[model samples]
Target: MRILLTSALAMTLAAMAWHAQAADPERGRSLAGQCRTCHGLNGIAKIPIAPHLAGENRIYIETQLKAFRSGKRQHEMMSVIAKDLSDEEISHLAAWYESIEITATMPE
Candidate 1:
């Protein structure tokens, strides 16, 4: 009985941890629609003020997101936006963003 109880508790804890890590790539793609406004729908930043997301390294993206979420980096808009995102959501967004093809036009 004790063994069974221990197994059940372990399973329950694992499930909860996994729930924190849950993410959906398709949902991430849809979520990125909001990002399209400033960054462009194709992940291209129209102006120099913005950085492009497409084809960026996933680890780099995650690092930056963590910075924003943790207040290690200070950016008013980004912090507020990132604070609510779970690590899983960030990963999903990173995967989707990384998969986009990168291209930029030469400036005049």
Candidate 2:
């Protein structure tokens, strides 16, 4: 009985962790609407002030988001935007942007 209980608890924790790792691109797409203004079309924030987000790595995006949220990465606007985003929201957006079908075109 004790072993069974422990196994069950561990499995539950593992499941929760897995879900936490799950990033929903669909949800990310919805959340990204707010980012569209600055990031611009196809993740190319044609504006000089904004950084492009399309085609970035998933882990990289997550790390940056976490940093912005934690106030570790101080930027002119990123901190302000990330300050209010929930962990789940950040993860979702990361997934969406990371999976974007379009890549930004760099200027020569």
Candidate 3:
């Protein structure tokens, strides 16, 4: 009974930690202000040079951002920008872009 109780407690703590680490969209939105110059506030690209970020997969964004931050991926601007980002900041940015709704329309 004691062992079972300890296991349950451990599981509960693990679940709480997981939830705590979940990305926050509100924080992401605030942090994403700087990203607006290129990606736009709504995650749409503002110019031809930038790619649209709206509704992109969170994992893809996180991976790319991490790569840029670590210098594994090279980008003139992105490398500079990503260098200052923390892991949490990267997660938030991913969440922000992933939260946007996007749809593709088929041209008839």
Candidate 4:
């Protein structure tokens, strides 16, 4: 039982490390060229129709993209675009957008 638990933990860790390695923010930046029309290169939305992605939670981004890819979520543009994205590509995009920082200030 102990051995089985240890093995499971090791496998989980390995999977996490592999996922971390698969996401490349630089590659995502390059891929973002296609997204720049709606989502700015910096992850801000170019149009009001799009939502800002900068500093978004990584898991949230991944979840939404996966949903779009799987047809669980429907958006006219996102559904089509996400259909072609591999899991690694989604991870990279999530990593890149999550890496950005945004600040908001309250009126004084």
Q: In order, what lDDT does every prediction score?
A: 0.78, 0.83, 0.90, 0.92
Better of 1 and 3 by TM-score: 3
Superposed model 4: Cα runs more than 4 Å off: 1-14
lDDT of 4 by residue, 20-57 (tens): 77888888888888889999999999999999999998
Candidate 1, residues 1-108, lDDT tens digits: the string is 999999999999998567435645566687777678766666787667879988887668778989999999988778988898888888777767877877769999
Off by over 4 Å in 1: 1-24, 103-108
| Model 2 per-residue lDDT tens digits across residues 7-69 | 999999998688556889889888888788899535778678888888887778889988988
Question: Which model, 2 or 3, shows the larger lDDT?
Answer: 3
Give the lowest summed-lDDT range of ten residues in model 2. Answer: 40-49
Better of 3 and 4 by TM-score: 4
Any runs in candidate 3 off by more than 4 Å, and if so which?
1-21
TM-score list, all predictions: 0.68, 0.71, 0.79, 0.84
What CA RMSD would you report for each candidate?
Answer: 7.7, 5.7, 4.7, 2.0
* Cα error, candidate 1, residue 45 (Å): 1.3
